[model samples]
Target: MTWSIVARDPETGHLGIAVASRFFAVGAIVPSMRGGIGAIATQAFISPLYGTDGLMLLADGQSPESIIATLTDRDDGCQQRQMHLIDGQGRNAAFTGQKCIDWAGHIIDDDVSVAGNMLVGPNVIAETLRVYKETEGTPLPERLLAAMDAGEAAGGDKRGRQSAALKICRDQDYPWLDIRADDHPDPLGELRRLYAVAQERFLHVVETMPTRANPHGLTDRRLIDEKIAALEAARIADGRPSPSFATPLKPA
Candidate 1:
């Protein structure tokens, strides 16, 4: 019913997940992350509690395997559940329950996990990992998107696609970057397009901000001068003339 990837960019320590399913608002249920903590994706007998509870365990210094065991041990429904977890250290773990529907499986790689249940084929998870690893030199979101595209191409959810989502986070004031395309006919493709648009918007905003607020913190004095010049030009264009000074030399 769903396919997902939970991953960390080793170079940047950024955490992210990409997911799609024949389900409504997959973003709301399938992805969860906290800055400087970890990320979780729970689906197929989808246990929403795992998202919060797992993060709490991670916060308490639990390993991914230990956290997974605790959750699976407490739940009688574990056999039908699927989950993927990645810790702050980039340790990854994933599980697909025994009773899940056909073509259900998962792949755990270095700092990443890909999982799916009732998928078109077992190759979905494999292809997801392949794409994630092979698509290098790209931003975290772009790499995640590439993994999602590979899963879709390998035949995603057996039930078909309804919604898709991406979530990424870093250690910043506002670390979450989430995008979703709910109730779309081609949700994965739409998600990819939206991700590209979002990247463009982010770049545009960065380029437009005052230099004093930029990462370099070096003011662009020329830009300020250009703006002042533009304002004066606007006033001149509107036919507003400067006042002239007069002298009284004859009276003197």
Candidate 2:
């Protein structure tokens, strides 16, 4: 029914998850991460708590192996669930239930983990991990998306695509990027498009967003506008199609 990747950017400590599934709105349910903590993907039986509580456990200094065991120990449905995590220390672990559908399993690589159930075959997760490894120099978000694209090319959910998602968090408590194709014939592609569009304008605006490091953020309108324009120009110079971002709302 689902497969996912949870990873930490070695260069940035940024955490992210990318997932795709035959189920609708899988994004809203599967991925959870906290900056300076770790990430979790809970699918198969889909207990949302594995995501929420799992973060607390990780923050409490629990290892990925201990976190998984604690979560399954409390859930009666563990036999049908699949879960995986990578903690702040780079410790990673994964679980695929005995009752999971065929072709279900997970792989742990340094700084990343890949897991899935009800997929076309083991090649799906394998190729996903392979791509993530091959793209080590790419940004975490793009690397995750690339891995998912490879998984889809290798034949993703046997039943076909429905929803997909990408999430990324830096030092901020909130996500740096959270995009979803909740219900689409080609959800992964849609997520990728949304990511590209974000770079065109939204990501620049985000730079001005108030954060722990920039409590006041950027109040200079000219500076913000210049940054955004520069980003748009860079996109065009790369021979990429430009985005149709709306005019920014006038500050009230």
Candidate 3:
């Protein structure tokens, strides 16, 4: 019913998860992450506890493999669930319950894990991992989207697509970017559009928000405006279009 990719970006140490499913608001339950800790995607008899408690275990410095073992060892319904994770140390692991629907399984690699249940076939996760590895230097968010797109092309959820989500956490407890299309005709496509819309102004503001290093984030409106203008100017000078939700804004 769902497939997800959880990864730690080697370039920036950011943690991210992207998920899609033939279920309503899959984002709400399938994906969870804490900046600087790790990420988890729980589906197929989804358990929100796996996400919340799993992060606690990650914060405790437990290995991804250990965490999965501990969690499943305690859950009586473990055989009906599926999950995957990537810890802060870049170790990754995943589990597919024996009782999960056919076509259920996962792939784990250094700093990344892809898992799914009720998917079309093995190529779904295979293509996902392939695209993610191929786009090495791309930003984590874009890379995630591209990987999921490839999986969808390879045959995503055997049932159909209903919702999708993309979440990225750089170095804070909260997410740097989190977007969801709870229910849509083309959830993955909607996610891409939402991400593009985020680039327009939302992400610029996110950069100025409070973080651990700077408890008092950039609060001066004038300086914030200047910083955004500078970035936009640089983009234009490089022949890139301005970021905008509807139309690209012309450089002033």
Candidate 4:
């Protein structure tokens, strides 16, 4: 019911997962990652616990293969499960249950795993890997989203696509950028648009940091006070009252 790629961007040390499915809200189920930890995709029988458990195992310093083996060993329904994992070191691994529906399988590469069950064909996974590798020069999330789009174009879920998602995390301690498109007519497309919006927001946050820095060594304290006053006025005009300070000018 799902097709997904779990991967590490070797150049950025960023971990990400992209998934699309005939299932509703696939994002809520398949993709998972933690900053500086690992990424995992669990589908088919779709054990959600594996996401948390796998990250914990990686955090405990387990290797990717060992973590996957332990996870598979503990699950009684392993044969019906599909999973792809990547550790912090960019090591990758994947598993597809022999009992999965027709056209089910996975492909593993140096830092990525692409897998799908009940797909239109094995080419879904193949095309996903090809796109990921070919788009290596792009940002991790954009490349992952492109891979999902390519898989969908190659014929994704046999039942047809309903939802898609992209999750990525960095070692820097801001919130992970997790975006989803559920119950959309073209969920993967919507997910791509949302990812673009997220990129803009990330840039806005990054730009705000520089504004806080004192770019000039000017000792005129009054200039700082005047700039603060102008900023407060602008915020008030924008219909957002300042939480910290009162309006510089009193109400008439």
Candidate 5:
């Protein structure tokens, strides 16, 4: 029903999760993260508590392995659950219940973990990890997306695709970027479009938003506006396509 990647960017210390599933609105339920803490993806039977409680454990300096054991050991539904996490220390771990559907398992690497249940086969997670490792220098968001794209190519959720999501967190309690294709014919493609659109304007605005380091953020908009203008100019100078818009369809 679902497959996901939870990773910590080695270069930036940013944490991110990319997930796709045959279930509707997978994004809202599958991913949870706190900057300077860790990330969690809870699926299969879908215990949201794994996310909330898991973060508390990570905050307490609990290892991903201990957190998973503590949560699953107490849950009656552990056999039907799948989860993975990576902590601030860059340690990672994953779990797949024995009772989960066939083709369900996980892979844990240095600072990343990939997990899934009811996927087409093992190649899905394998290729996902492979591409993620291969794309070392790329930004966290794009690297996660590229890995997911490879997983999909390898045969994603066996049932089909319905929703996908990408979340990135840097040094804030909230995400740097959180986008979803909750319900769509091509969820990942929609996510990519949204990511492109974000680069045009939304991300620049996000950069100006208040954060712990800069409580005032950028009260003046002039600088941000100039930055965006400069980027747009650079694109044009490079002969790149202009900023794009998703136009609404006219009534049939």
Candidate 6:
């Protein structure tokens, strides 16, 4: 049993997904996205092809609705699956198979699509959308965490928690961030800690990594180190504690 959200940040054009489940490593198969194509979450019976093929279809100029129809039409197991997606244009669609376990359904918004099966109740999806809409000014990743937190508070997957994941993609071929708590008593909380760990230095390091537009991106190691140090200093000065999981930077 699982619940997930696939969304496009309208202002940033970033795409991502956040998911929690009783299943192990739900993130590995349920969520998928391409920088500018779109994002998808396929769950319940977990048809991974919906994620891989869905992105391919989204890249091929198919709307989210068309993609869903095509995907479910070709699969005989559609009746047991749960899926939803948002397209490059922000067009959204979802499918909760007729035979999915109880408390299964989806809710679509202007830029988001939320879906779940075997959840505690409709409140799981409802509270997720509510919190997501109310926290619009927050960054995409934080907003996603907030929404997921609300769902958990409202009673998440009826079977209980086992894993969680967060994936974010910016304007590049590679993901900007991808973190998972594959098997944990508190997967979402673990995910939040990892998010804090990423902010400590990893995220800044990502900004300096090579990209298509900047093949030799910020290669001056000393300068990059200076930037990260400066950020850490500023964060400490503001009274925010640094993530303890962050390790000392070793010299090159």
Candidate maximizing lDDT: 5
Question: What is candidate 1's local distance difference test score?
Answer: 0.83
TM-score winner, 4 or 5: 5
Candidate 6: regions farther than 4 A off: 234-241, 246-252
Off by over 4 Å in 1: 202-252
Best by TM-score: 6
In TM-score terms, candidate 2 sits at 0.92
Every candidate's lDDT: 0.83, 0.91, 0.92, 0.81, 0.94, 0.92
- Give per-model CA RMSD: 12.1, 2.4, 3.2, 7.9, 3.4, 1.7
Model 1 CA RMSD to the hidden true structure, in angstroms: 12.1
Instruction: Report clash pairs, candidate 2.
Output: none
Compute the lDDT for candidate 4: 0.81
All candidates in order of TM-score, best leading: 6, 5, 2, 3, 4, 1
Compared with the true structure, the alpha-carbon lDDT of candidate 2 equals 0.91
CA shift of 39, model 3, Å: 0.7
In candidate 2, what are the lDDT values of residues 1-252, reduced to their tens digit? 999999998888999999999999999999999888999999998899999999998989989998899999987889899999998778899999999997899999999999999999999999999999999998888899999999999999999999999999887888889999999999998998899888776777877888988898888879988877787678768887654456755978
- Residues 159-251, candidate 1: write the lDDT tens digits: 888999998877532345788988898998888777655543343343444342355632565764565557557867999743322242274
Of candidates 6 and 4, the better by lDDT? 6
Query: What's the C-alpha lDDT at position 86 in model 6?
Result: 85
| Cα RMSD for predicted model 2 | 2.4
Off by more than 4 A, model 3: 227-252
Worst 10 residues of 3 by lDDT: 241-250
Q: CA lDDT of 203 in candidate 3?
A: 91
Task: Give one digit per residue, the lDDT tens place, for model 5 in 1-252.
Answer: 899999998778899999999999999999999998999999999999999999999999999999999999999999999999999879988989999997999999999999999999999999999999999998888999999999999999999999999999998998889999999989999899889989988888988989988999999999998999899889989999843665743878
Point out the worst 10-residue segment of candidate 2 by lDDT: 240-249
For residue 236, give model 1's deviation from the true position in Å.
27
TM-score of each: 0.80, 0.92, 0.91, 0.80, 0.93, 0.94
